[model samples]
Target: MTTRFDPRKALLALSAPVLAILVAVIVTSLILVVAGDPVGEVWSTILSVPRPRVVVSIINASIVYYISAVAVAIGFRMNLFNIGVDGQYRIAAFAAAVVAGEGWLPGPLNILLGLLVAMLAGGIWAGIAGLLKVYRGVSEVISTIMLNAIATILVAFLLRKVAFRTEGSNIISTTPLPEDSRVPGMAIIPDVSREVYGLLFLAVVVGFFYWFILGKTRFGFDLRATGRSETAAVASGVKVKRMVLMSMVLSGVVAGLVGMPLLFGQDHAYGSTFQPGLGFAGIAIALLGRNHPIGIIFAALLWGFLEQQSNALQITAGVSDRLVLIIQGVIVLSVVIAYEVIRRANVRFEQRKVAQALEEQESMTKEGAPA
Candidate 1:
């Protein structure tokens, strides 16, 4: 019984990312046409390597997606839906920014402390949902959703009350951190045409860590086992309760880190204007990528590309960025469908194999009985 490596499953996994990019392109083109902008310019924005700034923007977007995708994928692996990543990120970003904006601490140390605080903030925020699901037997989907709202309102309130200030006499909700606290540019790669390259290293590390946690660690085993079957896992003596809580916390920490680039690297502080939908975007990325670390990287990259070119759609094709969300919805729907198809096929294959084995054993027994 020689079994060949199945490429079909790989193809299925690849389909979502490919379809997402295609949808993005098509929508952008339509927008361009409607807006009286040349669709060619929009396409060029995405494909053409112009100056280093566009390249830098591309890199920044990619890093954000990669980081956030992994954060989403962690809860997915543990079978705990952590949908409040956006709120978690927002809260954490605010925490990091406030701490760094003081200019009261040294550069490297301040940055380190800022990130640590951000992680803690995100973990605590997510822990609420975890606690609800674990002890109260509440639905995580519901709890996380509500928690997102709560987190958003709370962060908004804090910015107004606690951090209700900005540099140079502005009435902004938050103060911008000094440049010294930001991640240094990629000094090693000169002429790379991008200043915000520190995150490239972070993205690489994130990928490796993601794969390692899911593929190498014992904790990963517990998470996967629980995800595969909670009943079986509990019977096998796995601490389902603890696993759920820890996984959610860890997932939130990763989500919190997503703000580093924006809060610390770019903006130097959290702002009310910063988009929170990135967390939702992370979910789309996780699903499209099949919750695999490597798959998430490509999915994130594709999403980043779509978003970057969205501006072009508005200018060149006269399309709106809202079209990007529509395209994302289509891609997500297709990915879900693909997943179901693959799951059903695998179940059928297993059933057939078991039936064949049982029949073979019966036939052998009858023959040996001398009939």
Candidate 2:
């Protein structure tokens, strides 16, 4: 069935993010003024055209961020806050590292096997929280928070005690994967020393699948229904509990890929230097993107650009790199407030339309009756 589009509704939908961004800019500028910093210089530094290498770095970073955000967005869509995405990706990357380090299979097969192991590890870790929520009536937020700590400790222990230590290195790390197993980097940009991660394609594929599953399939419909109202979904014959479990697992499966771009394309091993907190960052990006696949890509790129600018801000503008963090926080808060305001406005508009329709119906009936 073709759905009729409302231009006014579309305009309202577009306005929220734009309003949020404008508010963030104003707030950030005010903070800069209060701090006695050169607001214009900071803004100029942030908006300055980056070098080719920096551009490549931004793209590579955005790829990882996009994948991570997509993972979080999946859980968000189901109204499930999978806070343990950070932990899931960490543990999964560690497992993938160990498997790839083994080099038990031939080149391509070994890489594929490691990827599969990562997905399984992530799914299992996230499934624990899902199980508790479904069967034990536990709050997923609390359970996942605890799971994050547990996963951190577990990964540390495994790294310290079980992982093969690289000789003469100060940092502890799993055995590095064989050269053949490492994914090749793509020279997508000219005159750039750094190459884009080959796994950029993976992010594209994940986005495509996320959009297709959530927008075009029966399972997606049921999942969304369950998210909106479990009782209503149950009345509609959707198995809410099963959807809960599946959604969490599916979210984690994507989470497992959070580190692949870094792992396969650069690090080639999980180590002390492996970046943390990406899963948490994904939450912010997911919110900024409104949990839409396409929106998440732009949000991730914006995040990546800000991150890349942090260094330049420090060197050129002499501004604290932490300013980026403040900006990010402000943007998220603004977006949340804007969306809430828009939601209330939409509700009032609908109510007014309904009231008007009812009044007109009553007037028509009275006119038809004998005076």
Candidate closest to the true structure, highest TM-score: 2
lDDT of 1 by residue, 1-371 (tens): 67687786567556656665566556656765786766665566556544556556766787888888888899998887888898888888888888778877888888888888988988998888899989999988898888889888888888887665545855565777777787866644357745765756767877798899888898888899998899999998899999999989988988888878777666666776675687888998899888887788778877876677666656655656566666667778766876777678777977998999999999999989954
lDDT of each: 0.78, 0.91
Model 2: what TM-score?
Answer: 0.95
Best by lDDT: 2
In the order shown, the candidates' Cα RMSDs to the true structure are: 3.8, 1.7
Please give, for residues 212-327, the per-residue lDDT of candidate 2 as tens digits: 99999999998898999999999999989999999999988999999998999999999889999999989999988889888888889989998998888878778899999998
How many backbone clashes does every candidate have?
6, 0
Which 10 residues in a row give candidate 1 its minimum summed lDDT? Answer: 42-51
Candidate 2 residue runs with Cα over 4 Å from true position: 164-168, 361-371
TM-scores, in order shown? 0.84, 0.95
